[model samples]
Target: MLVDIGTEEGNSWLGHIYNLQGFVQFRLGSTEDALSFFNKAAEAFRQMRRADDGPWLVVNYGNLAWLHHHLGDQAESEAYLSKVDALMKKYPSPSQDELHAETYAEKAWTLMKFSNDRELLADYFQRAIKMQPEMVEWNTSYFLWLVNTSEHRDDGLAANILEKMRVAQEQDPENFCLAACYLEQRGKKREDVKDEARELAVKVLRNPVSSYNGMRAILRVYSNYISIDEAIALAEEALELHPDERYLKRCAALCLKRKIRYFRDRHTNQSMIDRAVSLHEEVISLYPHFSLVKNIDLANIHAKSNNGMAKADQMYQDLLKMDLKPAEKQLLYNQYEKYLNSD
Candidate 1:
């Protein structure tokens, strides 16, 4: 996944990817790759800030300190630790917080990816944005993160939150993903966004493909408001434009799943089921780390298809045999119960 990000994104994001990848490698017990990634992260940060070093390197240096300590190099560890201390003394946090603004921002981004602690995550983002108002991406990313994280909520976003998002969306004109999210929130609040969604869809389709290109979010808006068939068509068009892009594939599959799983009254055709099944299977292959969720989606898709209960049943049984974490096991159990009740 880090390899997919490459260095095409902004310098700060590239450094973030490298830093997270370094930590993942170390956790996997590959100290050499971890060291390499940490060095790459330092360089990326240097390029991002247009300097050799800054408070941004605080986490990088701290990572180095920990890595060296684990490697039994007391001198190296102490040297890196001293570097961290000097950096902190020279460039203290902008706020009363113990961590620098950059550190807070990075921690917020990292934690958002791995955890669901809503209050802690929102607080970190708030601190980072308040301290470093110049970093526009942080604000946009924070808004988008909030929008995405609150997807399963029964109640939609509040008016004040929407107003703040609208302001942020205006400030960062180039972030189409945030724009799509704003539109989605408005639609959820019973606003008329059909024409706006159509225009945004055209613009997103024209833009170069990216992780934050807004296509996925746009598909969601279209699937919910404009037309599910059109959403599937849009996803297919994007996938055709970039066949190897796993993100696009996931988007296509998700659009198809929504159409099949919910809008079954709209011409429940064989080709749609086959396409959804195939796309989910391919998505499972492309993102093995997230297969549990995809696999459950696949099973549900099968259950809704013609004469596919056996395959779906067997898949659920297979998942039951795997050594999943407690959370995943509980989710599977809940979903399975729903699947059985549907019968």
Candidate 2:
């Protein structure tokens, strides 16, 4: 409309439209078209002396940053984001809490994607949260990011973030984001407080759909603390909902292995052995790579209580017959030979 009416800065409006159009195209997965439009939009914004005030300037910068990042042009992405960051600092955040929080949140997101600097992202997110502490999502994202990089430094930062996350949850009950942050913090500190972390995992499992990280946290917890029965039940439930979930399938396989080990002393029970065999077969079908981890372990599992060395040998031989990589073949051969020599 601005262009049609010959209004002042009408060309600027076209650039804004192109920028928005580019964003829409990107979301729809038209990378080439999106980049074309973004480039055009950025050129126009640069031409417009008032580009700083151009509606699409910030958004265009962000979109271009993403496009460049995906294209593996990390330098270009950082440069693009730096432009926006400079403009943002010049303009500064709004005094209003909501608007201030939004500005900081966007800055934090750009920092997260554009830089590998963990401390910088943590600072941006913390600033955003302080700007509007009501923004539970920002707090959660920060906490989770901290968890991912926790292995890098032990500045007690993870614990501090977790403490803040706990407070956020207290302020905002039913906040799955906060819950996820809390669960991850607990899971990473599992070395000292396994039981507590396991309990937290059970709670997280009850609502795994909240976030993928939360679900993974639950799986890790169950791996350590839960009984095989409980783990199996949960894995079955997860598979029922998402049959194609490879991670859950792996967990199920591990749980079945644990169950077999559990019932080893109770071998008088045939049902346990049958169930373990069935689970292992299911794992082989779902995750063939997992079944090839080691030949002896595979033989032991496949040959376990029923008959004798014959069944185990056959299973091991069948594994060896497969197109094993040299490394895999060596591993299996070593395991098979070791077992043979042991008895």
Candidate 3:
């Protein structure tokens, strides 16, 4: 009915339906589809000259900005955010509590992306947090932001953030990634964090291989303090699930590299080194665009494994053939010369 009546006086009502549909799509993670509907709604607003006349336009622009940012189009996202900023300036602050909370939350997220001002960003996050304390991702992301900032790192702020995340997790049991991230950020030395990270990684692994995030958590747990056998087993499981995942392959390769060097059994360890080389080659083959970095790693791994200078030189030559940023090209050149000088 909405589509059938999309023209005439019915067009106004149809536009609202499209706007709501776009919002629903955004919430469901169909961002690209949401953007298409939002664009249609935006055109309707433009044709009706209603862009500056309603609160709906304000939220619409903000949603568009967020969607564009997720799409990796920062320039387009900023442009839409500028529109929201202008709209906010023209309107008086709403008396409604919900509107106030949403306004602060959206502004806080936007400001966090806009500037390097930790103090200011923290203030905004705090306002948003006060409005909705149970929003775990927002709180944890802000907390991580604080943890990464120079002033907050030495002040035990990450610990406080971790505590908040813990409480949030208890309230929301399904938030595995959030729990994994919080535990991962807490580092691996503490027994509590290590146990939690291991648990979360196990849960995450059982779900899907497409989750780069879950794989990262599992890798970090093994990389820091887990036993060689356990780490190797987990890596094997992950590789079986996600064969084309370069990051997971890299994680497995790194573990093998360390195990090969550190273990008491020389013959058994050499097999591990050979496996790491093979995994690195698979990653390189799958992601040729990153050949420069991949080949460098492969060359280093071969050199360490006593593969001799010939194979290493060829890997370096392959890296140099690609179009590279000046710094990347220079780094590869320096390494190549060092390899040539090696006996």
Candidate 4:
């Protein structure tokens, strides 16, 4: 998963990525690979910070100490322990009783990717925020986590989550991703979000193209509140700008699917269904391990078209032959039953 996170160098999260890769390697019992990745993470931090050491290394050092301990190398483990001791003494925690904010922040960030224990991680972010409230990025990440994991509200987020997003938008004024999400929650409340959504589209479009996911969020606002045609146009424009972007293609395909299947109240031409099918097929290939839902979507959309049921049936048969887990088989059968019963 980390291997596909783009090839952009000098990324701020490169060190975190390396550190996480090391952790995953160690978990898989690849001690040598884990050590290599841990060392790479140290080097990544040193190069990015233009320094040999800082509080950021605290977590990396702890990982090394634990790794050596696991390998039964007491001497090397103690060496890393000494380094952690010196770093902690050099940069004491703000509360003296609590951890350094960097450690807490890194812990929160890494665990977000690895663990589903949101309550514990939320506390970590909170501790980090309390120790260093000026870190706007930490604040933004905290609020974003809350927004994503919050209870689903048909019309909008819960009141507390809404307030967090509002505060996050203010703190992260230039974060079009958060801005777009805020617009969606507001739109769900029946507010007039079209103008703001349009303005946000302009800002997101003007920004230099990168791998940031703000564009996806903005597209959601358009898909839900604005015209699906306009949403498709925006998604197509994005795809044209970055034709090789699998993420953008996936988003575009989803937008097209919505217009085809869900928005049947409106006119959808054969050309639209064809584009949807083409996009879904490519996406299915592009993400072979994660394409079950896409396959079902492709089948359903094709089944709705003239003389396309044969392909749909063949796809379903192919899925039936795959060694899906029992839970996956249950889901596939559920969806397949729906498809078979459809007019």
Return the top candidate by TM-score: 1
Per-residue error for 215 in candidate 3, Å, reads 2.6
For all candidates in order, the CA lDDT equals 0.87, 0.60, 0.63, 0.83
Q: Which has the better TM-score: candidate 2, or candidate 4? A: 4
Error of 2 at 197 (Å): 9.1
Of 3 and 4, the candidate ahead on lDDT is 4
Q: Which regions in candidate 2 have their CA more than 4 angstroms from the true location?
A: 1-61, 64-91, 94-116, 149-162, 177-213, 250-343
- Give a tens-digit lDDT track for model 3, residues 1-343: 1222223332323344456667768889898779988887667666664453444467678778988988899999999999887776666454544454445554555555446776767776787678667655556556445534532232334555567756765665654545555555555325456576677778877754432245554565566556666777788887788776555676677667656545436444456667878987887786666667767767866766655457776777777787889989898888777766754
Deviation in Å, model 2, residue 12 alpha carbon: 31
lDDT of 4: 0.83
Q: How does each model score on TM-score?
A: 0.89, 0.46, 0.57, 0.84
Candidate 1, residues 1-343: lDDT per residue as tens digits?
Answer: 5544446545347788888999999999999999999999999998888999799999999999999999999999999999999999999875564678898888988887788888988888898899888888889989988888788764568889989999999988777888999999998988889999999988888766766788988998898878998899999998888898887898899888888888887576988999999999999999998899999999999998889999999999999999989999999999989988985
Shift in Å, residue 104, candidate 3 = 6.6
Q: In candidate 2, what are the lDDT values of residues 36-151, reduced to their tens digit?
A: 98887777667764544532367678889998998789999999899888767665665544334545565565565447977767777777788677656566566656665653
Most accurate candidate by lDDT:
1
Q: Order candidates by TM-score, high to low.
A: 1, 4, 3, 2
Across 1-343, the per-residue lDDT of candidate 4 in tens digits comes to 4654432555555677788998899999999999998998899889877899999899999999999999999999999999999999998887767889989999898877778999899999999988888767678777667656752667668777788779878987876667877888888788889999998998877654544446777888898788888898998998888788787788889898988877865378788889999999999988887789999999999987779999999999999898999989998999999989887
* TM-score for candidate 2: 0.46
| Model 4 spans > 4 angstroms off | 1-14, 25-52, 64-81, 94-97, 206-212
